[model samples]
Target: MDPSRSEFAIHEAAREGKAGVVDSLLNANPKLATQKDDDDRLPIHWAIANNHLDITSTLINTRNFDPDTPDGSGWTPLMIASSLKDNQGEQTVDLLLQKDVEVNAQSFNGQTALHFASSKDNLDIARKLIEHKASTRLKDKRGQLPLHRAAAVGSMPIVKLLLENKSPLNASDVDGMTALHHATSEGHGDAAVALLKAGAETDKRDMDGRLAIDTAPDAKVRKFILQSAEREGIEIVTS
Candidate 1:
């Protein structure tokens, strides 16, 4: 180890997009390229998080780096890239995919890279993950898919994209609550409408045997769900 270099000097270089410095460190100590930060994030993890596409490519392709290594949060480099809110759009995501990063790798919550990408409303990231074989059907530990997260957060574009991916619109969570259940309960009427249009089973019941309308906290939400349900030729049972 270089006396002046901290344990995370490689990480710092990757995060700052100092490709040359990172190359030097990786060359001097190839193992340092894979060393985890305080958060258990390797230098590649920092590269993805910071959207250093060139550095990420160098680490992944040239170094034959491990892209599946998880961070302290059980998040992989792909997951970190998906969660990135910066980085000139999908440049980082695309680079990871080119290196064969596993898009469906799960975090501690069983949330895939797609989940984080959708939650961020990064259409480019989401699309890239999907294109790279991210499983749209895989749910988190709670049984909530990317669509459920999008619906709950009122991300219409993500909801639409997930629906287009043919995600099971009526797939339920651990509570047996479907994406519609979340959208209605969260008062996301527009999301509910989009879901219904995408063939989400509106009458699907939760573990409590309650429909989406039953959990709807407001009359407007209930009314919208009811309207969409009627249009979808499904019965809405509110208790």
Candidate 2:
């Protein structure tokens, strides 16, 4: 068999997540296991990304696949799992983690698994990542961390978990807007309150010198801010 032809077979098996085909080919030529496709995705990336748990298991356990292989987007199996939107994704994530995959690994966005998990509002996955000491301090391209993403989406459970994990509630984005600022501007009263309760400094102004209260979308939210400020004994001088 031509070596290039064998490489093509390996690539096909990898893309289809056919562990048996991949194993057969790999066994015939062990070097084929390391071959990458055009997108630089190894067989392991496809198996995990497609939720082929059996293939993934075979690749990891029997074939000793590298868990950290990055696809075209610099997304490892763990990073891809973090972005999963269904129970199968959850299962895949859990399986990978159980195999001791690097839980806090970052993606092209500079987001740890926790950041991506929170982006999907998967409390179970979020909790699992947090429990593994997934870095809450990591910021994505937007300079927003996992906690900021959770707060923006009004994911109460994930926000709570992130707060419990000591995520920086006051961490600001490029424009100097904190999670509380985002929550307030978007009229997510509960999320705003959560951030404030988590000790997010309400008085911290944004780049435009607007506090969280000034960004409230409506009077009800404005009232909540005023009340909260009063309760916290913070002074707000407004015209």
Candidate 3:
């Protein structure tokens, strides 16, 4: 989306990682830090999304800055930071965590920061959120847990972490699919095996009346999961 004119200077600056320009803009008008862009996002949102910790910290220090402020989509800075590419979003995540914010705050879709982090396979951010006592069992609007998001993306470490943190091993979503279902359907053989090893029930069926293996995108995925289960001594009754 194009900037809505000169009012977006600080937003653009933060988005571009122009620390100096952001500082200058903030110095000129401290309120710019809290000003929402056409996208309904504050400068802090862009800074955190771009992984500019310096700019993020600067914006945080501004007067009356709401650390848990939601954007147009009701996503907090933590959610954006969690979804960043690569593994460089930790600094921003840490910075936001240090502030007075809701660690388990949900978005418009009831997605927590953990959901974003897990969906992107951001292990570090997920760990940080977990350390901060982020809930492993908070289901999204779709009734999907963070574990489901992690499994769908084949984020094994996150899946393990959530499981270790006592996220329900077989919680079904609104669609009646568990994390195992998500892993198998997405062809994440390793994830499916991990869930199975963690004791995900194989007999559970989805709303479509398909077992987890039956939801696999193709026969190859189903075969790999079945073979892996066999190697792990986990019997999967496909008959």
Candidate 4:
């Protein structure tokens, strides 16, 4: 009955994937659904964070449930769901989405569900979020867009998807690095090529005045970017 005892009974049940127990506990004390545990997370936050779809569904149906409620770091359940990497994650996203969850809610750092999906390279979730009207252009605290995260992680499909959704092709982050810069510097050749073909400015210079190609970590990636740029008729200009 102590709030400081690590977690609530319902939280333990949810984290451990005990669907039946979670249901019973919620029935006993529906307020448990909204009660913050030791981690400042509601029971549903744990359920969805652990990819327990059934528990997430149960928690969502509880009275006064707010799909937009955030955890300690301002990470909403939808953001957490987007970061998950399985079919259950999809189910969880769908479950919360049915409640008209705020797909665009940002965390403490201004990262939305789209940002998380892009960062995790979850194309399906990213697509789903986009369908729900999540913004592809929401920037994080560092001014890095979802497109930037996708490029940095070498997620070519995600990069393409965000671009299709109108992510600014040449948007720069706090470091003045564009998505192309991230892709090239991280050594993602295919992604770099994709960015270039999509009309990414080859001469975009970062804070250090380094071009996207100049930021490439090696001769191979640099060579690929140059070759791909040449093929696409995108002139590669140095800073």
Top-TM-score structure, candidate number: 4
When sorted by TM-score, best at the front, the candidate numbers are 4, 3, 1, 2
Q: Which pairs clash inside model 1?
A: none
State model 2's lDDT.
0.76
lDDT of 2 by residue, 1-239 (tens): 65436547766666576677877786777766666777787777777667777776666664546767777887888877777775356777777777777876777867777877787787888878777778788888879989888877778888888888878888889888888888889887778777776777866888998987788889998888678767876555443
Could you say which candidate leads in lDDT?
3
TM-score of each model, paired residue for residue? 0.84, 0.79, 0.94, 0.94
Q: How large an RMSD does model 4 have?
A: 2.2
Model 2 CA deviation exceeding 4 Å by range:
1-31, 214-239
lDDT of 4 by residue, 1-239 (tens): 64323448888888889898887777777788899977789988899889887888888988999999999999999999999864348888888889999999999999999998888899999999999999988899999999999999999989989999989999999999999999989999999889888888877788998888888898988888788778877887875
lDDT (tens digit, per residue) of candidate 1 on 143-173: 8899988888778988988888878888889
Q: Which ten residues in a row have the lowest lDDT in candidate 2?
A: 2-11
Clashes of each: 0, 0, 0, 0
lDDT of each: 0.81, 0.76, 0.89, 0.88
Q: Give candidate 3's error at residue 154 in angstroms.
A: 1.0
Pairs of residues clashing in candidate 3: none
Candidate 1: residue 214 Cα off by (Å): 3.3
Q: All predictions: root-mean-square deviation over Cα? A: 2.9, 3.8, 2.4, 2.2
